[model samples]
Structure formats: structure tokens, C-alpha cells
Target: MTRGDSTELAAALRQWRERLTPADVGLPAGPRRRTPGLRREEVARLAGVSVDYVVRLEQDRGPHPSSSVLGALARALRLSAAETGHLFDLAGVAVPGPGRVNDVVRPSVLRLLDRMQDLPAMLVDARTDLLAWNALADALLGDISAVPRERRNLLRMRFGPGGDEHHGPVDEHGDRGRLDRSSVAGARAALARYPDDAALRGLVDELLRSSESFAALWAERPVEDRRVDRKAYDVAGIGRITLDCDALEVPDDDQTLIVYSAAPGSPDAEKLDLLRVVGLQKV
Candidate 1:
């Protein structure tokens, strides 16, 4: 970046930092704080960077940050997708294009998740990386929060070794083969759309290396995207319940919101109500 560009970037960073409060990002608002927003140390900790680097960047003395560093800072600052692209531009890094998967969840989508309190819902990226889920989803599926961020992928959990060890409801439909094929097909379709995405390519490579079944299905060159399906889960202490799984598309971001619900007044619906109570108790 040019000197003038660096100056503007520095000023923008400072302004962004100062506009946010500790509560905005789940940090405690400590007493007797002189700063109007998050402290430099807090930002460094959140972004996994050194305090000195944040200082130098704010002062317009730091070198242009790499794309990964800029991404981390964007997430740390809770920047909107547009703001993230602007930050990349300021750093002279190419913003993720149509060839890449957009993993950033929009704020409005998150609110939609919040509003869907009666059913199990989750948001996943184009590659089926688990992004966010409501409490009902957490209770129905295994406690996904316990999984490491890098390992919290739907296909990885289904196909990776020891991935099924999580204690919770198990798929009782006896349709693993079909599910596996469809998942692989979806991944293949995502790969076709985002041929330049390193993470998607890496995931496909890892699965091919690790799973014989995945490799066999992938060899068939299946390329279908996920839509609506039926899933049956055997919840512990609640018996078996079957639910309709619907995939809602967010085409702009290449994301899907999956919602699990049962027919009204059906036995499964009653089971879901019980599960909601169970979920609240755990929380």
C-alpha cells in the first residue's frame, strides 16, 4: 500500500476500534476504563496478534497486513462483510472473489437464527462447515460447541475416524449410505463452484485420503447441492423422533440455513417440545 493509503487505513482502523464497546464482543466492561472502546491489548488478544503490531498499525508505521491477519482483525472487530472487504482493500489484499467460498455470516441471518426458537436450526457455509446454531440444534445434534472450530464440519464428522463418538442423538434412519453419497455430492458441487478455494480443496483432499467410502463416492463424480431431506434422530431419554430437514438458501453468501421440524401435533412434535425443555435445562 502507498503511504497515503496506509495513513487512511490506520485512521479507519482506529475509528473502527473506538466505535465498539467491550460488551459488543462479549468482553466484560471493566470499571475505571479510560479508553472509550476496547483496549489495544484486548484487540490483540481477540485477533491473536501482538499488542505492538496493533500499535504500529494504528500509528501508520506497520507494514501492510496479510489477508489472513486482516481477516482475523475483521472478525475481532465484528466488522460487517462490506467493512471486511474494505479492510482487505486498505491492506492491498485481494478480497475473496466469486471463486472463493464466503464463510462470513451476515448479521440479519444471525437474527433469523435467534428468532427460530421453536425448531432446531443451524447455518453452514457452502462447504458445510458448521458456522452457527441455536440451542435446539445444539441439543438435537451433539453439542457442537465442544468440537474444535476446524473440526466442526458435517462431512468430516460423518466420515472422519472416531467422528461419531459424540454423545447425543444418532441418525436412526439406517440411511447412512444415501446421506454419505449426498454429502459427497454436495461437496463436489461446492468444489466445482469454488475451484480456487484452498480450504475446500484441502477438505476434499483430506476426506479422500481418510475415507474409503468417501473416495468411492467421489470417484463417481456426483455433483448435487443439498436441499430438503428427512432425518431421524434417536435422542437419549426421548426415544426416536423423525423430522423434516429443510435447507434455506442464502444465495448471495453461498450459505444454507438448515431447519429441523416435525409435523404439527405429531408424536415427533411432542418429542421436540420435550427436547426443548431438555435443552433449556442443559443451558
Candidate 2:
């Protein structure tokens, strides 16, 4: 980036940092604060960077950071997807393309997840990486948060080794071929969107190399959004329960928010309420 761009980026980072408070990020505000919002140390901690690095970034004196670091910063600052894209531009880096997947959740999306207290809701990017999920989602989807961030992709879990280990409601569907087709199509769509994304390319390559099923399906070139009407689960305590599944699109970020709900006042609804309590405890 040019010197002017670097200066502007530093200014923007400082502005975002100063405008947010500890409470905004779910942190405790300590005693005897000097400046407003979260401290630079707190930002560094949240972004998983050193305090010195954060200072250099704010001062426009450090070397340019990688896209991953920028993504972490964007999430720590609670930036919208648009704002995150702008931050990357100023930092002399291109925003994540279709292939370059990042799991930075938008603040508005997080708010939406918060509002769905009863049903299970999860947010994923075009790459199908699980970004943010509510407690109920964790319960119904087998606690994606339990996995390492990189391994949280749905395509990976569905086809890779130990795939059937996740004892979630979706596992009860029994239609493996349909699920595989949908996954391949989703991955293809992401590839089409970001042909130049190395990480995305790597994921595709890895899947193709590892799974004969994935390779054969990819060769067929099937394309469609996989939305199913009803999903059944055999919970130990709840026995058999079914719910309607909907995949909503957040067009701004090219992300999908999956929501699972049952009919009101039905037996499934009562069981879902019981599972909500179960899910909250697991989270």
C-alpha cells in the first residue's frame, strides 16, 4: 500500500477501536480507565495478537498483516462484512474472494442469531465454514464449537473420516447420497465465486484427493442448494423428533443462516423446548 493508504488504515483502526466499549465485546470494564472503549491490550488479546503488534498497526509503522490477521482484527472489532472489506483494502490486501474463506461474523448477523433463542440457528459463509452458531444450533448440530476452527466446515465433517460420529439430528436423515450431492454443489458454487482463493482451492483439492465419492460427484458437476423439508433426530432423552429446516441467505456477505424449527404446540415443539434446555447446558 502507498504511504497515504497506510496512514488512512491506521486512522481507521484507531477510530474503530476508540468507538467500541468493553461491554460491546463481552468484556469486563476494569477500574480507573484512561481512554474510551476497550484498551489496545484487550483488542490485541481478542485478536490473538501481541499488544506491541496492535500498537504498531495503530501507528501505521508495522509491516502489512496477512488476511487471516486482518480477519481476526475485524472480528475483534465487531466490524460488519462491508467494513471488514474496507479494512482489507486500506491494508493493501484484497478482501476474501469466493475461494478465500474467512469466518468473520457480521455484527448484524450475530444479533439475528441472538434473537432466535428457541430454534437452532447457525451462520456459514459461501465456503460452508461454520462461523457463528447459537446454543440451540450447537445442540442440534453436534456442537461445532467443539471442533478446531479449520475443521468446522460442513463438507469436511460429512465426508471425512469419523464422519458418522456426530450424533446430531441431521445424522438421522439416512439419505447420504442427497446430502453428498448438496455438499458438492455448495463447494462448486464457492469455487465458482472464488476460483483464485488458495485456501478454498486447497480444501477442494484435499477433498478430491481423499474421497472417491467427492471426486466422482465433482466430476458429475451437480449444482443446487440442498434444502430439505423435514429432518428427524433420535435423541436419547427426546426419542424421535422432527423439524422444518430452512437455509436463509444473508446476501450482503454471501452467507447462509440455517434455522431449524418445529410447528407450534406440536409434540415436536414440546420436545424441542426440552432439547433447548439440554442444548444450553451442553454449550
Candidate 3:
């Protein structure tokens, strides 16, 4: 990277960091006597880097950051797609192209989730990483916020030991098999689209080593995309409730917004209303 690029990058990083608050990134706004926006240490922690590294970068003395580091910082700062691209440019790093899976959820998409307050909705990337979810989804699908960010993947939860603990039970109509197959098929499609995504490749490798069921499904070489389906969840106080799960595409980011809803005036709808009332207490 050129010296001019490094200076611009440093200034840009500082400006971006100052424009955000702790609450924006789900961090606690602790009592303090400090400046506005997130502290350097908080940014470091959120971006999975050292405070010294962040400091060095802000001081215009750090080495050129890798693309992965830039991506992490982008997410940590909740940067928009354009802003992320600008960050990569300022760092003199090649912005990830269409060949890479886009993990950044746009702000407008998040607003869409907020508007669907009565319904259970969540955003997942192409590789099935659980990025964001609404409160109602937290009630219906168990407390996903409890799951670590790295461990909040659909495939990982489906195949990992004790995975079913949070998801409750599937319906008796063989929907479980279909969902599993769909997940595998979606992963296969993502692999085809983003052949160079190391994280996606690593997830596949981990699953192949850990899950024989995944291995069998992968061997089948399913290549279908996710589609609308019916799924059942046994809420604690409400018993079994089935909802129509719809996969809405955010094509620009290669993300899908999964919304769960029940037919109007149906018993499932009543159960969902009850869930809304109870508000994750029984979850």
C-alpha cells in the first residue's frame, strides 16, 4: 500500500469508529467518562484483533490489513456495502467480488426485520450463518442470542452434538428430512457460487469430519436452493405450533430472510399470538 493510501485509511477508520455508538453493535453502554463512539479496545474486541493493532492502524503506522481483517472491521462497524468497498479501497486491498459470499446485512433489510415484529424472522447468509433475528423469532426458534456468533450457523446446529436441544421437534410429516436436505443442498449451491470462501470451506470440512449424516447428504450431491416449507416447533407452554417458513432473498448480499408465519385465524396463529404475549419467557 502507498503512504497516501495508508494516511487516508487511518483517517477513514477513525471517522468510521467515531460515528458509531456501543448500542449500535449490541454492546452495553457502560458508565464512563470518555469520548463519543466506541473505544479502540471495543473495536479491537469486536473485530477479533488486538487493541495495539487498532491503535497502530489509527496512528497510520500499521502494516496493510488483510481482506479478512477488513471484512471483520466492516461488520464490527456495521458498515454499509458501499462503505465496506471504500474501506477495502483505502486499505489498498481488493474488495471481495461476486465470487465471495456476502455476509454483510444491509441496514434496510434489518429495518424490514424490525417491521415484521409480529412474525418470526431471521437473516442468514448464503452459508447459513445466522446474522440477525427479530425478537419474535427469538421466542419461536429458541434464544439464538444465547448462541455464540461463530456457533450460530444452521448447518452447525443441525449437525453438532446436542443440536436439537434448542430447535425442539420437527413435524411427523417428514419435514425434518426435507429441511436437512435443503440445508445441505443450499450449502452445495453456496460452495459452487463462492468457491474461494475459506470460512465456508472450513465449515464444510468441519461438518464432514464431525457428521456422518452430513457426509451422506453431501455425497448425494444435492444442488437445490431453499424454498418455502412448513415447519413445526414445540413451544414450552404453547405445545406444538406449525408455521409456514418462507425464504425471501436479499440477492444483492447473497442473504436470505427467513420468515415464519401462520395462516390467519388458525390455531397456529393463536399460538403465535400467545407467544407474542409471553415474549420469550418460556423459551
Winner by lDDT: 3
**TM-score, predicted candidate 3 vs. hidden true structure:** 0.74
Instruction: Compose the digit string of candidate 1's lDDT tens values, residues 17-62.
Output: 9988876654557788897888988777656678899999999999
TM-score of each: 0.73, 0.71, 0.74
Structure candidate 2, residue pairs in collision: 99-194
Clashes of each: 0, 1, 0
Cα RMSD for predicted model 3: 4.4
Candidate whose TM-score is highest: 3
Local accuracy of candidate 2 as per-residue lDDT tens digits, 199-234: 778889998999888899999999896665567766
- The lDDT per prediction is 0.79, 0.77, 0.80
Error of 3 at 224 (Å): 3.0
User: Which segments of model 3 are wrong by more than 4 Å?
Assistant: 1-77, 86-94, 168-175, 281-283
After superposition, which runs of candidate 1 have C-alpha atoms over 4 Å from their true positions?
Answer: 1-78, 86-93, 167-172, 223-226
Q: Order of candidates by lDDT, top first? A: 3, 1, 2
How many clashes does the backbone of model 2 have? 1
Worst lDDT window (10 residues) for model 3?
166-175
